[model samples]
Every structure is written in structure tokens, then in C-alpha cells.
Target: MKKTILLLSVLFLLISCGKAKNKAILQGKVENEQIAIVSKIPGKIVQLLVKEGDFVKKGDTLAILDIPEVDAKKSQAEGAVISAKAQYSMAVKGATENQLKQLEAKKMGLKEQYEFAKKSINRLSNMLKDSLVSQQTFDETFAKYQGAQAQYNAVLAEIDEARKGARIEQQTMALGQQDRAYGALQEVETANKERYVIAPQDMSIETITLNLGELALPGYTLFNGYISNSTYFRFTIPESQLSSLKKGQEISVGIPNSDKKIKGKITIIKQLGAYGNIATAYPDYELQESLFELRISPLDLDEAKDLITKTTVTLSL
Candidate 1:
């Protein structure tokens, strides 16, 4: 009777161990898709409007940067635009009334000189024909007459040009300069808008990389956090157990120490190429067996939206 009792007890213990191994609980954690907010230009943070754990929507102002250089550039561009516009206007319009009057007065003086020089040359020419004056004297008078006539003709041409405004080519060049200045001013305005750091999408702030008054470089991530409504569950299992789960399979996940049960669907079943990529820190599967990642999305996002990320949850296989 004693030997029979001992045998029966060993058999019972073996059965219990087998049942325990079969009922082993599989576990995973909640995760969310993360994003990084970066600046396109370098500047110092003048004001930080959001903090860790703050929820923000798209287009919300998250911070303000103090880029003194942009302000200076805007001023310079504005001045250039003003100067270019004045030059273009001047090119389009003829010379001012006062300027035309001054040219006219100068022309009148040159005309008088020309007439006086012409009479002196005529008299010298006649005198030379009779041997009354030297050839050198007549030549000097003729040179003076030619100089006066050239001066009068140049003045008339100058007056005509002043009335006709600038040439077509000159007007076109001035207009081009004005356009270039406007383009520069627009570029500066765009940069000035960058001073306000706006959120690209709805997200929950997890970390702020820079503090107030800290300098942020171009392409530097200033905020790091998770996108809104992006929570999902990640599980790692051995290939041997992968047959039990299929893509698009619906499953129930239970939170440990809580009564909440979340309904989720398997969306991804991919083999982990490296050990580091495994979701579980300490896997219970055989070392030789290849690990696979199972990404399950919540069927009802509202239920899982408030779940703390990276928290453990149990799955029954």
C-alpha cells in the first residue's frame, strides 16, 4: 500500500507540471509611434510654451525663437526695396521740371556762344582771303567756332533725352532690380515666420530637448514625443509559437493588476532580424529559436488611447 501511494503521488506531480507549462502566460507592452520636432533654422529659444505631458494640436505654437539676424535682414531688404522702387519710378518718368529748365538755360548760353563764334570765324575767313590776317589766326578762329557748335548740339541732344525718359533697356533693368529687392524682402518675411515654432501634427509632448534661452541648430530635434492616437501593442514570440497567431487575428489583451481588457487585431508578424530588436527584454523561449514581432493594433482606439505606454499586459495563448 505505501509503494502504491508514492507512485500515485509522483504521477500527480508530473501531470501538474505539464498543465503549468501549457498555461504559461504570454506578455507584451503598449507602445506608440514617436516623432521628433526640429527647427529649419538656427536660433535661440526665447520662450517655451509647452512642457512634458502637455497635449497639443496641429498648428499650435509650441515655442518662440529669437533670431535677431532675421530682423536685421528684413530691415535691409525693406530699404533696398524702397530704393529700387524710387529708381524704377525715376526711370519711368522724365527729368523733373527744374532739371529741364536748368538744361534749357545752359543751352541758351551755348547757342549765344556758337552764334558769336560763327560771326568771328566768317570775319577771319574774309580777312585771310585778303592777306589781312595770318593763316594761324584764321585756323584758331575756325577751331573755336567748331567747338562752340559741337557744345550747342550736345546740349540739344541732352535736353531731348531728358524729355524722353530712360531707354527701354534702362527701364527694364531698373524694373528687374525692383523685383529682385521684393524677392529678398519676401524671403526675409518667410524666415521671420519661422520664429514661431508651430506643431506639425497633434501629439503628446514627452520631452523638451532645449530649455528657454538655449540655442537650437538647424535640423536639431527640439521636441520628442508620441503621435496622438498611435498606441499599439507589441509582442515577441518564438517561431514555434507563431503558428498559434495569424495575421489579422483578433485577440483579447488584459492589463495586469487591472480589470481592463482591450480588444486588438494582429496587423504585423515579422521576424526580428537582430536580438536587439526583440520587444521582450528577457525572452523565455529557446535561444536557438528565431524571435518574431507581433504588432497588434487596438480595435477601439478610444479604449487604448489613455493607456500608459510601455506598460505590461498579459495575453493568453
Candidate 2:
């Protein structure tokens, strides 16, 4: 009976000590900075690189879209661009001098024909004056001269037209068309890259929300999720503790259910309250105020994972 009494007394003392420990009833949850993986453009999902709870690092591809259509369009545009370039080259380097010589020869022939028709018409006019050529012959000769003059004008216009538009200018226009086509093709290619979601940050991919073969598009349901490389729990201390919490102040972050721990610095300490009131003005102004937010960064973040988001433990208050 005496031994039983001693055991009961010890249990009561242990329970009393446990009740005396300080614990704040804080309503906080565990979560990393969840980054919503997004697609850059619209396309049908062709390949899913991960599933739910799959871990990934930065630059990891989450999924790829069916890009065959885009590829075909790009190819078509590319071919057109090539053809345009060839046309531009041809326009810049015009027809050879030999071809110009042929045109000049034709011009000379027309000139000779025009001169002969004019001389014939003049002779007919003189003949009519002498009553040697008939009126019908004079009229026909005049008409022939007019027709020859009109033909000469047409030929001269052709030569001028050839000189008006330069071969280089034509080539430049064709090159511009090619550049536009090439830009369009590049845009399509860029869209294709965006369809395959990649890790936007250097952190790990915490989850894959959608399954493989699922249709994913921009602004649609995302299939992948990410978080920061390092994670930390937050603590708010009274304004009185601001002086104590300086930059680079050593902090011990406790890990629950494991022997692991992270040593970090007191990276941030609010010098003023939410209303921008200084700490010295607090007691003179009001008693009802919220604690300032403090930022702490882990010195060794090798395993400072999102899993340790909520690390609630006894901190000097």
C-alpha cells in the first residue's frame, strides 16, 4: 500500500508539471509557398512528366503538348520564307546585260520602223501637193505613221518601267515578307515551348494535380505545382523583443518527431508597427496592437523543406 501511494504521488506531480508548460493556441497551418504551375499557351496535353506527390527541381518539365500541328505550320512558314528569300535574291540581281541588249535591239528595230513610216508619210503629203499621189494613198500613209509613233511610245514606256523599279528594292520587299513569315514561325515555336510547363523556380515540384493524357491549357486546371527551395515557420514577437531580435541573430528551429534541426538568422525585425508607429511610441499611444512579423532564414537549408512548414515549439516570448 505504501509503494502504491508513492507511485500515485509521482504521477500527480508529473501531470501538474505538464499542465504548467506554456502553449499558445495559435491557428496556423502547414503549407509551402504553393506555386501554381501554368501553361504558356494553348494546346492539347501530349505528355505528363509527373504525378501527384512527385518531387522535382527547378527547370523540370511538367508536361508537353501535342506540337505536331505547330511543327507543320512552322515548316510551311519556313518553306515560304525560303522561297521568299530566293525571290528576293532574284529581284536584287536583275536580268543580265545580255537580256537588256536584246530589249535594246528590239527598241532599235521599232525606232527604224517608226522613222521609215514618218518619211513615207512626208513623201505622200508632198506627192499630194503635186497631185502625184492619190488622196487614198496619202490618208493610208498618214495613218501608218501615227500607228508607228504610238508603237514607239509603247516601247519607250516599257524601257522606262524596267528602270523605275530597282532589283534591290524588289529584293528588299521580298526579304521583308520573309522576315514576317520567319517571325510568325518563331512565335509559334515559342508557344510550343510554353505548352510544356517547367519549374519556374529553383525549388522542388511538390505535386502533380492532374493525371497523364489530361487536356491542359492556359488558364485551365493546372496539373503541376511547385514550392520554394527553402521553407520556414513564422513567429511574431512583441515590440519589446525587437531590440533583441537583430539581423543575423542565431535561431534554433526545432523539428518535431525527428532529431533534425535548422539553424538560421533573425533576418527581419519590424522597427515600427503596422500603422508605422515606432516602438518607442507604442506605450504612449495604445495598448491594443498586433505583434510585428519577423522573417527568419535557415543558415543550412539542405533539408529546409516545405514539409517543415509548421514548426510550433516553445520560443522565448
Candidate 3:
């Protein structure tokens, strides 16, 4: 009879303590946001500036890539720009001195031929008047004179064109070519800059996925880091207790096995499905029970700075 009474007393005390603790505290985990550093351009890793466990700040150089393909493309674009500029200059300046001189010489030669043909036609007409030359012969000579005049006129037009520079349409086309080459060069340079991987924010390098001389493909993650600002506490509570919580409301959190209590703000509250897995201090919480989730951020960053991630914590509302 004495043994039975002692067992009953112990069982009741254990149940009472569990109920008291569950009503006052909620369970949560400490977590930080993970960041993956990826490259936009694929290339061999030329240099690794940070190793695992290193702390880095925003815009810090993380690594460098050796991209021979980008260099080759940049070179081609530069050459194209030079060629386009020369073409544009030629269009704007019209013909060169040597070209103009050659056209003028051709015009002079055509003029001499035209004069000779005119004299022949006159002589043929006179012969025909005396009936010494056939009418067919005079007709043929007149045709020759006309051909020479037309050729001389054409030569004069060409000389004028050489003196005047290229046409407006030609100049516009050359300018477009130059613009295209410049745009291409700019694109290559931008991509080349991307090869120098840099940290986007303050973080701790958790992992280095690629080593020196390894190929890093485009969009592939090269490093994994933890963002300090993303640290937060997540708690699972019974839905019956959710009415007491609201976003942006301040609350006190109790750290297990430590006297250092952290001040936090209620940042989120959401209901979970009956089947969702969650971490909570309440041992009676079951899959069939209705539960709510709460996310809180530390109001005092310094106090929670040393907290290890993914560790269980207790929350007081």
C-alpha cells in the first residue's frame, strides 16, 4: 500500500510540471539565411581569394576567372570598331587625292577622244557633199562621234563624284557599323567583369565548392555563405494560443541552459497543416493537433550574435 501511494505521487508531480512548462514557453530553432555565390559566365578558376570559415563584406573580391574566350571576342570587337571608323572616315571625306587624280586623267583622255571624233565627222560630212564618201560611211562616222561624246560625259560625271565625298546614305551606313561594333565590345567587357566573383553582402563563407583550376559553369554555385542579418527564431505553437500573438509586437525569449535572454519581435505568424513537422517544447503536440508557426527576429542583435544556428531555443510571449 505504501509503494502504490509513492508511485502515484511521483506520476502526478511529473504531469504537473510538464503542463506548467508547456503553458508558459514555446520551442524554436535558431537559423540564418543561406547564400549561394554563383557565376554568370563560365570559365576556369584563376584565383581563389577566400576559403571556408572566412568572413567577408559586400563587394569584396571572392575569386577570379580565366576567360580566354571573352578576351578573344573583345579583341575581335576592337578590330571591327577600327575598321568601321576607317570606312566612316572614307565616306565622310569622299575620294582620296590619288583617286581624284586618276579620275581627272581619265576625263582628259575621254575629252581628247571626243575632239578627234568630232573632227572625223566634219571631214566625213565634207566628203559626202562631194559624193566621194558613201552616205553609209558618214552615218557610221556620226555614230562614232555620238559614242565618244557620251563616254566623255560619263567620265566628267565620275570626276565630279570623286571630288565630292561619299554619299550621305553611305556615311550613315558606316556610322551604324561603328555603333554595332562598339555595342558588341561593351557587352564583352561587361561579361568579363562578371568573371571576377565578388561578395554581395556581409557573410561567413560556409563552404568553397570549387577549387583552383576547376571549371565553374555559368549559373553554378561556387560558394555557400551565411548572411548574418538573416538570423531569426522559428517557433511552433498550438493554434489555441495564437490569439495572443501579433506581428511587430515585442516579446521576451528564454534561451535554454543560459541566463542570457534575448529580446525579439513577432515578425510572422501562420497556421500549419496537421501533417507538417515542427519543433516545439510541448511533448503533447501531435500530427492530428492544430498548430501555428511564429517567426521572430532578435531586437538586440548583439545579444544573439553568438547563438549557434539550428539550436533549439525557448520563447516567452
TM-score of each: 0.87, 0.64, 0.84
In model 3, the Cα lDDT at residue 224 comes to 96
RMSD to truth, every model? 3.1, 8.0, 3.0
Pick the winner on TM-score between candidates 2 and 3. Answer: 3
Residue-wise lDDT of candidate 1 within 95-166, one digit each (tens)?
Answer: 889999999999999999999999999999899999999999999889999999999999999899889888
**Candidate 1 ranges beyond 4 A from true positions:** 1-24
Name model 2 segments beyond 4 Å from true.
Answer: 1-20, 23-33, 67-76, 96-140, 149-175, 221-224, 236-247, 269-292, 303-317
Screening candidate 2 with a backbone cut-off below 3 angstroms (N, C-alpha, C), the clashing residue pairs are none
Least well predicted 10-residue stretch by lDDT in candidate 1: 18-27
CA error at residue 117 for candidate 2, angstroms = 4.6
* lDDT score, candidate 2, position 64: 76
The residue-by-residue lDDT of candidate 3 on 1-317, one tens digit each, is 99999999999999989777777777788978899999998899989999898989999999999999999999999999999988988888878899888888888898999999999999988889999999998999899999999999998887776667678998899999999989999999998898899999999999999999999998899999899678888888876677788999998888889887888999988887654557675544545668777888999788888888889898764
